[model samples]
Target chain A: MNIQNPEIENNVFDVRGLNLWYGNDQALKNINMQIEKNKITAIIGPSGCGKSTFIKTLNRMIENVPIVRTTGEILYHGNDIFDKSMRVEELRTKVGMVFQKPNPFPKSIFENVVYGPKIHGIKDKKLLMEIAEASLKSAALWDEVKDRLNDNAYGLSGGQQQRLCIARCIAVQPDVILMDEPTSALDPIATLKVEELMDSLKQEYTIAIVTHSMQQAARISDKTAFFLMGDLIEYDKTEAIFSNPRDKRTEDYITGRFG
Target chain B: MSAAKLEFLREGREDTMLETDQTHAFERYKVKIDSGRIERRVRLNNGLKHLFSLSTVFALVVLAILLYRIGVQSAGWLDLQFLTSNLSRFADKAGIYGAILGTVYLMLIVVPVTLILGVSTAIYLEEYAAKGRIQRFIKVNISNLASVPSVIFGLLGLAVFGRMLNLGSSILAGGLTMSLLVLPTVVVASQEAIKAVPGFLREASYGMGADKWTTIRKVVLPVALPGILTGSILAMSRAIGETAPLVVLGIPTLILKIPDSVMDDFTALPIQIYYWTLDTVLTPEYANLAAATIVVLLAVLFILNSVAIIIRNKFQKRF
Candidate 1:
């Protein structure tokens, strides 16, 4: 692989020998990779391969679950995120996440978008409205829903609901956005829309996406990381990994061999 | 052709035709017989079911008749004045004013306090408390308390709030006792209401980076409020009808004046009716007064329930 991009040196996330366990059952083992700044990095692996767990650990979201244990060093912009001084809420604000399913609160569409900002103590109505509008625009849902901001979010279509969730995350203005299969629950058309949105969002935010679809990763991501049995199999540019993978297992996974 | 061969063939053809006709006739008769039997059986079964249903109606009618007879016997004494005026020294002139005031006073204190304590306890148990032996024990005790007899609670109130606390025979003492008596019911009901709220709503709030308290405040509580209110109202209705505890707490059978303070002596509606029934003369005036009081109490209960239903409907429509 061509290792000539000096910009890659300023990785937003520099993971080193990350390991995770859920009470003696190892979920992630020895994952090491560098996620580039202002680029979308997609982690693709088969079911039960720790792709989701690895992403969750980035924001310390897994800490909420009892019996979950982790031993690792994850550097965010060269600072260890798991340090004692690091607050989980602060870390979460910096590294936001959208779940696999669209989970908009049973509230108004406007409320759903502004939920994050409100939690952070943003009380100015005008500012919140602007943020809500901008975030929805970024998620490509503003046009369809701008006229009905007060409508219940559950009334939206599945794809619209997913976009609303994305808008909610974006409203917080996080530096990094972590998505765990954001489009897996959507149809092909909705998936394409989300992929396009992700592409646009990468220009402003560093995105780490965990997807089950290899084609989706290849289509939307600038970098691709493949994992197998809780181990990082390969990490490279999207084109190189898909076309000329360095590891046999990575090649096999990309070519539709046994996952 | 030989004559013998032709004769044998003709005979076989004739025999086959006759047998076919006979079989067709027999099949028709059998079908008709089976259908008739099935139809008769179904009719008989339907008739038996009707008879059973009629018997159930008869039983209900008998119960209604008994209720009506008792009501008729008591109606002669029932009158508007008997409900509105205070009880007099003479059995015929006595009214239920003090009892009504006492019941109202007791409920005013019991309902609000019980509601607050019950809803808070439910929220704590359902949302914050960890699953452990202590939580389990508390849960079991709460369920047990709900099933404890009212008379036992009355005794408890007599000992704990009345004597032990030295509250004396006061409205405050009675109200506090009733609060304890009805708390378990309110808590259990509110807990069920809170549990009815979908988990997804909580998850959505959490995903938006809201803390546990904020999520519960903004999402869970609002959604569960209607159910909690309905449960609380039902529990309050039960509290209103309670007489054993008040009797045990030494609520007087009659009082000329309404209670002016929580520390003052009081009488409830049930105690007044009991007092009227105990009068050896069994006069029409006292009996009618008791009936009128019963009607007033029933009316109040109906109004409360209707209000709860209205609130529930309004909330559901909003959602």
Candidate 2:
């Protein structure tokens, strides 16, 4: 509710004074940050530091938990996502999410890619096929899966499944993509492929990734935010945050003194 | 070197020898295994597994003997005339035409009633019910009801549908009674099926901007449908084989005409077999008629059970 940072720019999201609780226990404390447009922002922290919870709160996906209560204001494109006048479905359509594990539906691969567009009321068959191909192509999956688009998505390997999820996320043409450790479940080869995809994806979409690997954050992100014990310790350019952190705690975490 | 330093060096050399021996025992050496002891353990494990399998075979052998006895008795009497002719006082002139029609009509009523009520109850409990005291209470009571005697459900049907509602031993009354008798079975089976759906599929639906109800209808229902169909088949088989409930409802055991409507009086396959078996005390020939009817009833049950398994296997989806 309080804005500590007075300066503003063409940021995609302006989050301020965000606090969240599950039942009686607080999960995320008062936090403030700005997310720039067309750039990949990485959130790095130890386990249970509220990285996943913070991204879930961005699209109100945490509302699925029966005991969750949040008091915050996240403005996406200058409109408050939590405002009563804003519908949650519309908010989710603009901000898509990919979970840690690959979770394709039991349906065919083509169905998985076009699920978002179908849910949003796109009914033309030709349009849906075109969307599926374009989305798969964008996720770097079309060449590998084009011949077997009608097969069940579950038949794919773990790496391919993750890319299918990525294709599903982009099918709806969302403005922002939020990934919660999308590479944690993948092999090193698949992890590198997704990391390479993220580099090119930032030209069109605002990307926010939560990662446990400090090197992954250093490798892919334009900006890096370090969180510890429900607090944002530092947020700066990726190089400065990793090389010569301003906060002593951030320096210690980067140099492997402690987490 | 001084004398004390020399003594210390000698102690260090001895400690090094002990450390190497300890490390060699755990980290570097491969201890010999006793193959004789391992062989004895494997034999004991296999013995228990074989015992369980033998028990299963023993039960099947008993079933085979019973079926063989009934098959021999029914071999001469099972014919087209035996199936098409109406029931008669003379054993040679009797048939099961009326019972077959009665069963078809009864199922027409019981199938829809049980399916709608049973499946709805399962969905409400599994998906909508909160994890609280009320949900737990309902779940325990439902499972307890499943284990209660089918004859108790018959008594309930007799008192409520037959007497209180004044339906008067009609096919409707019998059908309604059978539905109640099988309702608990259907509900329990459907609950298991719905619970078996993967959690990740529901999460995927919800993450794609679907509401709770939409997720249930579009994602959960399709995945759970095969299991639901399996449950319904078993429930119908249970209903078809049930007799005491219809008897308690006061359905006539000697209907001469086929039931043309749900409101018409009727008798089912089990009731026909029961009356014929009872008549064997007066005339020995009636025993053959009873055996023939038993063979038909068993065939129907086996077919129903097989259909359930086939449907389950055909529609099962891998996630």
- Which candidate wins on lDDT? 2
* Chain B TM-score of candidate number 1: 0.77
Cα-based TM-score, every candidate:
0.83, 0.88
Instruction: Itemize residue pairs with steric clashes in candidate 1.
Output: B77-B288, B78-B288, B87-B95, B88-B94
lDDT (10s digit) by residue, model 2, range B212-295: 777788788888989999989999999999988888887876787778888899999999888888889998988899999898
Q: Number of clashing residue pairs in every model?
A: 4, 0
* Tens digit per residue, CA lDDT, model 1, B97-142: 6777888899889988998899999999988998678988998899
Instruction: Give the DockQ of candidate 1.
Output: 0.31
Clashing pairs in 2: none
Q: Once superposed on the true structure, which residue ranges of model 1 sit more than 4 Å away at CA?
A: A1-9, B1-83, B90-95, B280-284, B306-319
Q: How does candidate 2 fare on TM-score? A: 0.88
User: In model 2, which runs have C-alpha deviations exceeding 4 angstroms?
Assistant: A1-9, B1-54, B314-317
Interface RMSD of each: 1.9, 1.5
Worst 10 residues of 2 chain B by lDDT: B26-35
Per-prediction share of native contacts kept = 0.37, 0.32
Taken over the whole model, the C-alpha lDDT of each candidate is 0.85, 0.88
| TM-score of chain A, all candidates | 0.96, 0.96
lDDT of 2 by residue, A4-89 (tens): 44546568899988888988988889989888889899998888888898988888888877788888789998899889998877
